[model samples]
Target: MITIERVSQVPEDFLVDNPEGGAFYRAYGRAGIPDFELGCFIVKRASRPVTTAPFFIMKLPLNTMMPPGFLKTLLGRIALRVAFVGHPSADVGRIQGEQSAEVLELINSELRKLAPLVSYKGFDGSLGLAKFNKVIGLPVPVLNLPPDYWNRLKHKVRTDLKRKLKASAGLRLLETDGLPKEHLQRVYELYRQTCDNADIQFEQLNVAYFRESAPLSKYVLYFEGDLLIGFHQLLCSKQIMYCKYIGMDYGKSRQYKLYFALMLQAINICIRDGIRQIDFGVTSYAFKRHVGSEMHQTFNYFQHRNAWVNALLKRLSFLLEPDESELR
Candidate 1:
């Protein structure tokens, strides 16, 4: 028999011991994602030791109008399908041994007790997680740097980077663990602008998220004179430097080619530090591809406690999902 335990907080040692939990969970408790509760699910099987999975539980509303009598009962069933559970961030999920199927079954069983629907996000496609749930592919671009990485870049990319570097001479790059409140506020604004301009929207970071996550991250801030023009948040763990977040002044970004400059800076940092790979995150596929980044497919799995609803979701998922062609 498998028993699952939910806890509001996880022990520090648990994170230290489980490298499979990945780096995002290392500081997730303090990241302050809105409308989500940070917690871990412990899976215990009879005499065997326990396994833990960290996740963000998102409580969703059943019905805003509190349906009357029979209507309430009917809509409540549908509402149960509204609740969601997912990884705290990109590329994090773990289940031990041959128990991936069992763990997922147990999780879905547990979620049904609270809500009708639940989804696990950001599992690598290579895991074969699709066997038990409807899986969708979300490909992310990554750059694997070989020695002399700079010379491998396309001619156009190299020329563009040099031009941008020369044009950005007035800018000073500063790495810091914290930013002033005003600077933080400007960064937030640039982040918001970047999100607003995106073809597909995802999480929008708040100031608290940045302030709290700063300790685990290296903030590469580009300052033009006294003004903050752009910044890149690089999450460092082991030999991988993930380009987790970025923000820039839209108007000046185009004029001075701030994006190219920032990307080049990130590459230079990785080369100097001997980082193996850079997870460039999603979107901006063309530019990342031109600069030698390869595509790795990520997966999201969904299931509903109600078999009928689960079947319907599996069929209609394509309509609601993004077009893979967009990545090209």
Candidate 2:
């Protein structure tokens, strides 16, 4: 028999045996967002711990991905209070240790008591539960750093990247363990711009998130003379470096190819620091792929407390995919 315990905070040593368990949620949750209430679920069988999965309570905007028009405008305001079995900002949904279909179902059952919309978001692996309204959320782009990583790309990609790198060579690169409050404020502004330009905005990470995440974050900041133009935030887990968030001056992007430059620089850092893989994130498939990022599929499995509402959600699930025409 399995039992689930929901709590606002996990025990300090809860992550000791299960290192991957509640850390991300705990780290990012410290500086909380208004609508997002992050929490943890402790699962046990016969008093022995099974695993710890992170969850959050929030009002999820159901029409977050719908195209801009009359219908999107109309339905966009319909936010549903949801209990999500995943982290608010992390790329992967980690239900660490012994996650079978039964475990997921039990957790789902427990979460539904909190809200009508209970979802399992951003899991790359199967939860093995067929009853949920399964949908393809977004595919993450990952670039692996193998030997001779730079030369392996297509000649034109390499040439264009090299030219862009050279043109932007005058820009100074500052690698910092953390950003000061002044820089953090500027970074937050750029982050808002990046999120605003995105087709689907899942979580609007607040400025407090930047301040709280600063200690754990490594920044690759770009400056042209004295002006800060672009900055990329990175978080390392074992040998994999996750390119978590980026803030850029888009007006200067066309001239400097800021995105491409940052990506190439990340590759250089990986080669230098012995990091194996760079998780580039879910959007910008074309650019990420142009630079040799492989597509890694991620999924979302959802269930509504009401049967009729569950069926309707499944039917309207096609709106979750990125609505990119040319795949930028």
RMSD to the true structure for each prediction, in A, is 6.5, 2.4
Q: Estimate each model's TM-score.
A: 0.82, 0.92
Model 1 / residue 27 / CA error / Å: 3.6
* TM-score, predicted candidate 2 vs. hidden true structure: 0.92
Off by more than 4 A, model 1: 10-26, 46-49, 59-86, 95-98, 126-133, 154-156, 177-182
Candidate with top lDDT is: 2
Instruction: Output the lDDT of residue 191, model 1.
Output: 86
lDDT of 2: 0.78
For model 1, the run of ten residues with the poorest summed lDDT: 59-68
| lDDT of the candidates, in the order given | 0.67, 0.78
**To one decimal, what is the Cα RMSD in angstroms of model 1 from the true structure?**
6.5
lDDT of 2 by residue, 1-328 (tens): 7898887865566444332334544657787776888788888999887977778888877677676778778888788888988777876786767788778788888898889988888886567866787777678888888868877878888898789788678789998887777698889888888788876777888888888778777889998887888889987755778788888888886688888788778888888888888888777788788888888888888888999998988888876555554236
Clashing pairs for predicted structure model 2, backbone only = none
